[model samples]
Target: MNVAVIGGGGREHALARKLAQSDRIETVYAIPGNDGMRDVAEVVPEIGETDFEKIAALCTSKQVAWVVVGPEAPLSEGIADYLEGRGIKVFGPRKEEAKIESSKAFTKDIMEKYDIPTARYKAFTDYDAAYSYIESVGAPIVLKKDGLAAGKGVIVATDMDEALAGLDALMADSDAPIVIEEFLEGEEFSLMVLVNGDYTHSFEIIAQDHKRAFDNDEGPNTGGMGAYAPVRHIPESVRQEAVDQIVGPMARAMVSEGLDYFGVLYLGAIVTDKGVKTIEFNARFGDPEAQILLSLMEDDLVDVLEKVDRKEAFTLTFSPRYQVGVMLASAGYPGSYDKGHTIDFEAVREKSFVSGLKQENEGWVTAGGRVLLVTGEGETIESAIDSAYHNVDQVKFNEGEVFIRRDIGRHALK
Candidate 1:
């Protein structure tokens, strides 16, 4: 089968690599793909994700059997709906279901309506009203922008003063609406599920991403610093509860609301003393998490995605091994930074054994603002982190342009 993956990030590169290894796949194509994907698939340059008509035409012409939407922006723009409406098979949720990630206020409202476990939040379009609410709520609040702000929309304020500043920044200067939520204290985890409206299959629960730019959980938030699978922090009982109370309920609620959500349902969850509560919902896969999950997935990528797109029931087997992924970004990332910086991967690959799997050097190249994802798999999370960091240390870029978190799997270590 011929498959096409949309987006130009490390996540898409990982997906392309996995699909290329499938025995049943004849060819894989990536639209506007990065340099890393060149070794695994044919990179098409003309069809931008937002240009639906052009992309659809390319798919038809290329005889692409399946289309995988990678990023949230295009999915939120309804690319899946447009493709499916044209009788094309696509692995992504429709635009209506995508509101769960695109609009924070809408997601909070839906959670309240369906009784989904989540942090208490109040929405405001008026700046003064939101400021007043923040004062009442007091310090240590979570401020979120209603519209998409890349991954920096949500802010965890340390005090009332910081909370007010965040509100003003999001509502006053920015045209986007703001959502001020009660800050919930807990360790976080990421849960990804495959949903076909009526049926859903969950992957192994993994530790949450380190969104901050530096190590020791300090500094401003970036898209993500790194992540690992099979988080030891979450007990089996807690994971089961999350599946039952969070993932399953959210899937059912979306189906009941007349939205036939098909494809990946990414949930950002907090394991609070009161049980698990959802921090946010994403219609597609998570970045660094996706990299680690795909590394540990033993099933054929084509088979799993096709089943979901066809709305057929299926199960996936995961390797017992743990996987860790470390992201290397340009220094000023999550802010303004230089692009097109040259990277050297030869020294990086020699640092560790990554699952004992070897690949051609053509796969190593700078793809996005966040350039490379150094991953490792081991029998335990400790070994995985050790292996991943070993490889991450060897990579080099322009001076003062490389930034990554050093404590990707520390929670699991504890």
Candidate 2:
């Protein structure tokens, strides 16, 4: 079977690699795939990921059996609806379902409707109203742009001044509405569940992503600095409760609301002292989290995704070893930074997943904030982190324009 994966990032690369592992899959195609995927799939750079018409045409022309939508943008833009309308099987949620991620306010509203456990919040279009509410509530709150802003749209402000500044910045852009909410304190983890509209599904082994840009959870959040699978912080009982109270309810609620959501339902949650409370919902797989999850997966990904499309029942098996993925980002990442720096992936020994790169006569140069994610697997979390960083050290970028967190899986050690 021929498969096409949309999006050009670490998550897409991981998907492409996992698909290639299926003996049933004869060929895999990536639309504008990164350099790391060159060995595993045929990269089609002719059309952008959101170009639904061309993508549909390509699928028909190549007789591609399945198209997996990776990033949130195209999904939010109704790419899945467009492709499915053209009779192409897509492994993603439709635009309406994708609103769970594309619009924070929408998800919060659903949470409120379903009695789902989440932070108290109010969505605001006016800056002054938002500011007044924040002042009334006091600080240590979360300010989120109601719409998607990559992963940089959120500010966990500890004071009024910071809250106002974040509100002002986001409100300046009329397109960006803001959500001010009470901040839930606890250890956060990523729970990616595979669900059909029926609410029947299975959960992937839990993986935790470090969102802060720097070491020790300091600094502003980036897309994700690194991730590790089978997190110890979330005990089995807690995970099960999350599945029953969070994932299951969310899925059933979407169904009740008349949404046909299929594919990955990414739930970002915190293990609070009171219990697990949702942080956010994403329509697709988490980036660095996907890298580690795929590394530990023993099941044929194509089979699982096909089952998701068909809403069939299946179980997932995973390797026992821990998998850690450390992101090597551009120096000023999650902010303005230089691009087009040359890189050499072959020199690195660990498995490298490229998130951003452009091929030139000179070599592959960085094209996005996060350049690459180098992953390592081992019997222990310490060993995995060691392996990941060891390989990360070998890869080089021209002008030393890359910065990596020295303590990716350090929390696991503690």
List model 1 lDDT by residue over 123-210, tens digit each.
8888888888888779888998887666787788998878887877777667777888889999988888898886888876565688
Q: List the pairs of residues colliding in candidate 2.
A: none
Score residue 229 of candidate 2 by CA lDDT. 89
- lDDT (tens digit, per residue) of candidate 2 on 1-414: 899999999899999998998999888999867767888899888789988888898899999999988899999999889988989988899999999999999999999999999999999987778878988998899989887777778999988898888888888877667888898988888888987896556564788898999998889988999999888756888788889898889988998899989878898989898999999999999988998888788988887776776777777898989888888889898989898888887766338888987778857888999988888888888888888888877887655588889898887777
Give the poorly placed runs of model 1, Cα more than 4 Å off.
Answer: 309-313, 347-368
Q: What is the C-alpha RMSD of each candidate to the true structure, in Å?
A: 3.5, 1.4
TM-score of 1: 0.93
TM-score of model 2 (CA atoms) = 0.97
Please tell me which predicted candidate would have the highest TM-score against the true structure: 2
**Candidate 2, residue 284: how far the Cα is off, in Å:** 0.4
Q: Model 1 residue 48 lDDT?
A: 85
